[model samples]
Target chain A: MSQLDQSGAVPAAAENAAPAVSLSGERVLRVIVPLVMLAALVGLWAWYVQAYNIPKYILPSPALVAQSLVNDWPILGAALLVTLKITFAALAIALVGGVVLAVLLVQSKWIELAISPYMVILQVTPIVAIAPLILIYAPSTQVALLVCAWIVAFFPVLSNTTQGLKSTDHNLLNLFELYGASPLQTLFLLKLPAALPYFLAGLRIAGGLALIAAVVAEFAAGSAGAGSGLAFRLLESQYRLNIPRLFAALLLLCATGVAIYGATSLISHLMLRRWHESAIRREN
Target chain B: MSSAVSMNAVAPSGKPIVRLEHVSKTFSNGTIALKDMSLTIGEGEFVSLLGPSGCGKSTALRIMAGLGDASTGRVEWPTMPHDASGKPEREIGFVFQEPTLMPWATVYKNVWLPLRLHGVSKAAARERVMSALEMVGLDKFADSYPRELSGGMKMRVSIARALVTRPRVLLMDEPFAALDEITRQKLNDDLLRLWEQFGWTVVFVTHSVFESVYLSSRIVVMAARPGRVIDEMEVDAPHPRGVAFRTSLEYGEFCRRASQSLLSAIGANDHL
Candidate 1:
């Protein structure tokens, strides 16, 4: 895609040849199609529950879930705040730590050789398995949950950023050397900017994983109280058999996941829209 | 080859600014990229290392630029200025086969890079960067990103970046090899204009016989398979050579001789 843009004329000609109406149609379809599919799926699920007269505990109707969503807003909202706090905090920490570690690792092959094995172990080990250990060792339940999320989210940023740093255009590296740039100058002006698209890509992946890790860690900790996240509330509702409220909490989790994805994608787009291929909008 | 070594001292008028004395480069994989290559580039001269692929033309250029070290022999910059460290200062600009601009940077910032690395602030480098862009006819595009430009435009940006520091010598390794013929010819003319205007010694590496004949003051034809210089010829054409020269009898004659040298260079490898 970047190659196409770099060559310029061929893609420009192709872009101009594309009809304007179809381009606008594509823009419209992008949003409308997904919404239409979502509405249809919800309608089908609601209809099936109503027609079958399914028990509320067995399968709460969409309307009943919506009612529960409104009625239990204060409780669910607070739980959501707790989960969001953990997720964002973990993601922020992972982003900074991961990038710093990646830069250090790329500085020497020996450093990378020493540290990458441990990073791989962290990435491969299930958060569920580690969450209990973290909970036992951590000073607080929140700290444990944050640790779990960080473990899950940090690897992609580190690995992808490392690759990006190493993959800087060889010619540019030589050029920088020719100009007598210092190591720090090369890192900041060249490698960091070159690695940004990769970092953002990792951030997008880490964003989703952070939320997942937060939920999973909360589940594993299972500490129920006013400070508990939605995951605990989910367990509590399940044990109580309040299915509609469970569905409401589940809906909130799904919404939060989408929001995180959307937010990260927006960040990636805004940062890279002017240059990176993945972020640049191509007409078809 | 022995005769060509003697010819290394035969600069037209100006002093020998850069001299490669019996330089040979062997890669770690044990491929000898260059073997006993001897060439002399005079001040204000436009010399092209013309050869087929694997002829180590780019390698020789890189060695001169101090981007690579020769396994045997030495590169001497007899006329370059010395820094406080007593080492000859790196007073060379290089353009790769690819434009190689940072895609994220605007054209202005891309041109400002070498100056930035030299500890010149953006405000200090602004006028120089703009003038470099103006030389490439891209001053209006200072704010544009590389992706927003065409192939020729990007290459122009690369040239601007190389020129921003006002180096004493410009080393180009097939910088226009990827461009279309029309754009290539236009750049060839523009490059000649710059060379004439600044009087910077230029060592352009290219495989095209016609391009070498058209643009060079001297063409050093090289052969592949442990690449070595095989022949040297002077164009000796008058300055301000343009489209008229490209279609002239003298241009055709130079092109024919350069083409024969190039074909023989390739044929020499085929026999081995």
Candidate 2:
């Protein structure tokens, strides 16, 4: 029943300073174990490729895919740029549309009530089912792809920001009233700042969704005309029985997703690092 | 009963700064927050509404501050002689229980809120903001955000924001109730100093019997259920009440009398 030391440090004067080294050693083990496990998986994949005599079309080796990615760099790089453009265009439209919708909804409860059910329907309905219909009616494949992605990514921002705007504290509202602040002032100063954390969270979620939506829409629409992207390249590689090329296109897509996530989280951190609880340091 | 001199004495002749005549408030949900209450606060009197919770003290203060309209009575203010249009009066400042600061705003910007709302340019409002911050002893922290400050400091910023308008009357609803004892005591002293220096009427609401005795020249005890004023006590102690006076027997006697009146009000409220 001795009192445990709560300083979160080992006594430097004690012989048990060895525990600090042991703790850091445990941290190293924690990192190394995961790396070793990943290495084992890679070794097993290589071994299986050699032992099973699987055809390249059936299952290409990671090294072969990497090689093919380098070999077909010009085509894949063009596809990557096209895919990035679609993703960013769709995201920009979604951001603007979602924020406008959120402001409309917050300003008028009747509008929110009338529009929310349809917004939910759009959110829940499959984008794949809608993409072909959009392609036919949209006049342009690029517009169709952008619309599909915007539909997919816009709801989270709208819903999150709406909730955030509505979640301003009652006391704060009273303070605004006491100061004779107009509705616009209250919205800009109090509601918008209060809603920022929620909006950033929604943006992070929407960023990844926008990338997925762009890829999914391209997959469904067959990338006809000048709207070709990574998904079109994936389909093209598959049709040609170029498994390595397909894998390469997929790697690009995965990298895009990861990059979108990383960039959004960085932006969220940068914008919120000052005043938000989500970004505040917990320790003194 | 209808003598002119007595009626004039009852209702100060120097153009009432704020007059609540038979004011009543009843929520739509059938809760009567305030019963018919009549009160007039003079030009520079420091009055405290002393009551327990649910007594509608805050409601009363809000009515005076023009945040809420009384359901059954008229609130009147004397037309300022200097006003050209002879329209409704302006310049009332309100401080709530919570600091209610904009977290994203620096202290200087927070204090500038009222003036900014009134369409005062930043350059024009800068001096007033600085003076208000200086009055609250927060001149050094004007650039700091509310989140970076302690609770007491945040409340100081709230006070500074309220004072930046230089309102003729200051309505405070338990602004120091959330602070620690030491901070609360210090603020009470500082508030009186500011009140004396500005010569502005203060209609403060508080639950603390001791605070009402120490800070207010006049205490109005209120009861709930149908919130109404039960008694009014006058503290004839001189201004610039020091720390020594707080520890003095006279302070204790004043607190006891105020507490007795407050308890009786609460007791009367309980019977309802």
Candidate 3:
């Protein structure tokens, strides 16, 4: 969602000076259907709870969930910060590691052949299977959690960026050669800029993955005392049978994921808006 | 310098800019792109390599630019100067079939690329960059991206970029083939004027007889299926070939003869 929206809205949007008054029926339907569905879902949930006289332990009412969110603000907020920090740090580390590895990989065919199989093995191997191993090796639980998150978040970035780098226009490569451009000049001026869209796309995928990885790792770590993240909070709420608080924490995580998507999309828009076709708005 | 080209060395300078001596290129997969080709380009000559697709017109041009290796023979640059590195330094500009502009860069930056690679700072290259754009009549669009320009405008930027280095030899591979007829004609006239102004040797690759006759002082007609040159013609027409010359009797005569040569070149394939 972040990649698509940014690619569309970043570039050529300034040319759209006129405010469109005649919204098409399809566009209207797109907005109306999802919103109507959400309202119906919440209404059904409320009605079902009241009509069945369901207890709060099994499933909290929508109103009760909202009340829990407001009431448990301080605890949830701290947990949200911890989760967000781990997620963002892992994402940052993945970005640098992935792009650097991609650049080094593309420098030689031998290097790529030697390294790619291991990367594939890493990608295919489940992170859950490795989380306990990482916990066993690392001195701190935080480091172990970060390692799992980093492993999960790094591949999409490396692969997409490598594909982008390799796909540099053949004609443009010829052009660079014709101009007698040095290899370094070609890499920076041509290959890197060409890889921007792919990198940002990778960033978008990695953003959501970073969040999920952090949570999963936190679950495996199972830190119960203080300084725990939202995932641990979620496990604690479940063990205590605090269903409403669990739902509230789950709600916060979902909202955080959406926020991550929104942030990546905005960055893509700002960076690619000037010239990329994906960011351009054509007159239909 | 003679790494791949066959040894047929001779470089007598006065009139000729470069000599192609029995050059042939056959790909590793056994596809012959150019075979036993030979041609001599004179200084300040507006020469067109005119033939159909796969005729080695482009392959011949690439050999002259030293962009491709000729498996059979040599390309002798009569006037190429030797640098301190003991290699003949090349000062050549090549334009491709497409505009091939970097979409991310502004038109000014696109024109400035060659100079930038040559270690000229942007501030130092500003005048030259603007002048190249001015030659193509796109100075006003210096700051605009390639996508924002019309097709013709983008090609003009491509031309500006090629000309930015003030190369002694300009090689183009059907640079205007994708444009509409009107834009093609306009660019053809503009190109001729630039040739006259720059005093550079031009080896233009095109299939259009009218374009070749209108622009060239000489046309080298090529045949395909093991691409090789089969015919050559000297167009007695002068520079400043305009709307009047395009419709004139002599222009038609050159076009007619050129067309006949082209047909025979294509006809060579029918025999096979």
Give the interface RMSD values of the models in order.
6.2, 11.0, 10.6
RMSD in order of candidates: 3.2, 6.4, 5.9
Q: Clashes per prediction?
A: 0, 0, 3
**Docking quality band of candidate 2, CAPRI definitions:** incorrect
What pairs collide in candidate 1?
none
True-structure RMSD for candidate 3: 5.9
lDDT of 3 by residue, B140-244 (tens): 779988877777778888988988888888899999999888778878888988888878889999999999999988888888896877777888677677888
Indicate the TM-score of model 1.
0.94
lDDT of 1 at B212: 89
TM-score each candidate: 0.94, 0.88, 0.90
Q: Candidate 3, A148: how far from true, in Å?
A: 0.8
Off by over 4 Å in 3: A1-40, A281-284, B1-14, B82-90
Tens digit per residue, CA lDDT, model 1, A1-284? 12332355567657756777687988899999999999999999999999999999999999999999999999999999999999999999999999999999999899999999999998999989888889999999999999999999999999999999999999899989888888999999999999999999999999999999999999999988889999999999999999999999999999999999999988888988888888664534
Order of quality (TM-score): 1, 3, 2
Model 2 residue A125 CA deviation (Å) reads 1.1
lDDT (0 to 1) per candidate = 0.89, 0.83, 0.84
DockQ-based ranking: 1, 3, 2
Which has the better lDDT: candidate 1, or candidate 3? Answer: 1
Worst 10-residue lDDT window, candidate 3 chain B: B1-10
Model 1 local distance difference test score? 0.89
Candidate 1 residue runs with Cα over 4 Å from true position: A1-21, A281-283, B1-4, B7-9, B83-90
| Residue B86 error, candidate 2, Å | 12
Task: Please say which candidate is ahead in TM-score: 2 or 3.
Answer: 3
> Where is model 2 more than 4 Å wrong at Cα?
A1-54, A224-226, A281-284, B1-15, B79-90
